[model samples]
Target chain A: MLKELDPLLHSQLRLGVMSILMSVESAEFTFLKEKTNSTAGNLSVQLDKLSEAGYITIEKSFNGKKPLTTCRINRKGMKAFEDYVNALKDYIKK
Target chain B: MESENKNLSPEQSLDLIASMIRQTQGNVSSGSFYFLLWGWVITLCNFGMYILAKFYSPSNAAFIWTLTIPAWIITMIYASRQDKTRSITTHLDKISMWLWIALGITILPSWIFGSVIDWRVNALVLMPVGMATFVSGIIIRFKPLLFGGITFWIAGTLCFIVSPLDQYLIGGVAMIFGYLLPGYMLRSKK
Candidate 1:
């Protein structure tokens, strides 16, 4: 009776983003891009997927003249992340 | 990293989480700047007041504290700039910011009602500062800051027994230990 790993969180980039979001209150798009070492386009796509799943919230605003995007994990995302980790633990234990 | 959709095994997933967390936690420079800035400002002001009170005029010595007004303005401007430039805000960062703000809120009232409160303002100020520093040390996991916080508390407690003039000198020394030393250590760590 082991828990199943979360499909949404099983991917590399999304998991990386979620992991970063778990430790921080919020992070800019550039920060996620840099930390994940992914292209802006790939990071943007993964971020949108996370947002669509309601795992995280993305806010688009202007920092001076430039467009600024910030991402934060919500309660659902936190629960999902915790569950994913527990599931990983279960798999490893077996 | 470019393989955005690459599926991870359980072990890889766990490793990724741990690594990302380490990366996120690695950026912790925001607190050091403020610690250094306040350390210098408060230490100088304390020593300035001691010098003035000891030699020039006890009556006008309190005027030197007004330097903090300019320091406060600079802090505000610097915070705004930092907010604009910083890409990430960690929970530890927010917690430390609010902790200091809560302590700061208490300080203004203590000064305004100094005559009525009748406690040595040094102790009143240092107690909260010590608490903030201690908690900040725990949050950042920095040993020097923990020692700094202890020094502040000890100096604050001594203020209860010492003369008004000597309190200034003790407080100045405490600032050197509590803020400046740890601040420099934290800066160097970065």
Candidate 2:
């Protein structure tokens, strides 16, 4: 039986963001922006979507005078990512 | 890499994940400070003690070790500051941190019981130091540190064959190769 890929994770930017978050404890908004090579507006929108889905958490604070945003993948996110990869493998095996 | 927001095929998705993970691995190389600091301190102290013992006075040789107190303080301060400021922390970084902390604890008994162990303390310290270095190298995926760790173990073994005074010389040289050399290389990589 073929498994369905999570629609939320199928897009390029969100997948890239999630991939980077998976590798680290948490990442700054700038770090994600640089790694994904995404514009601020686009990255912010995708991050909000992930946050709304409860796959990840976003922390907004200040690093001195500048606004700092950090993102972390939660347990749900981890499970989802793992499931996504498994589904990916299933597709590849075909 | 712009946010095209386009959906990817399974193959493209897999490729993206692999490349992103590879990019994060480079962050592990930022640990050069501790290695370089300890390398210079230990090496200089070893050489200083050797010179003092051989030339001026064996009694004065032990005084050189006091420098480690300041080294300990600086390491603590640096680690605290780094923790507050670092934007990212990988599992590898956490594992490497705990490994060194455990190794440091293992080495403490040797220092406290230096009189009981005598000058063999150098060899004892080297073993755990080697373990930490070797493991750290593997965690960071750096080859020089892996070799450096082996160098420490070899130096430690050689210390047993030499006179107490000569052990200092070996320890000093070992730090140069095991710690300083790889440390500089890591810094350059960063």
> Ten residues in a row with the worst lDDT in model 1 chain B?
B111-120
All models: lDDT? 0.89, 0.88
RMSD to the true structure for each prediction, in A, is: 2.5, 3.2
- CAPRI-style docking class of model 2 based on DockQ: medium
| Candidate 2: Cα lDDT at A30 | 88
Native contact fraction per model: 0.92, 0.68
TM-score of each: 0.87, 0.81
Off by over 4 Å in 2: A59-64, A91-94, B1-12, B53-60, B81-87, B188-190
lDDT for B60 (candidate 2): 64
Report the C-alpha lDDT of model 2 over A24-45, residue by residue, as the tens digit. 9888888898888889999999
Residue B60 of candidate 1: its Cα lDDT?
86
lDDT of 1 by residue, A8-94 (tens): 898999999999999999999999999999999989988999999999999988867988899999999999999999999999999
Using TM-score as the measure, the top candidate is 1
- Per-residue accuracy of model 2 over B44-147 as CA lDDT, tens digit each: 99999999999999976788988989999999999977765777778777888899889889988887787686646889989789989998888888999999
For model 1, the superposed segments whose C-alpha errors exceed 4 Å read: A1-5, A90-94
DockQ of each: 0.82, 0.65
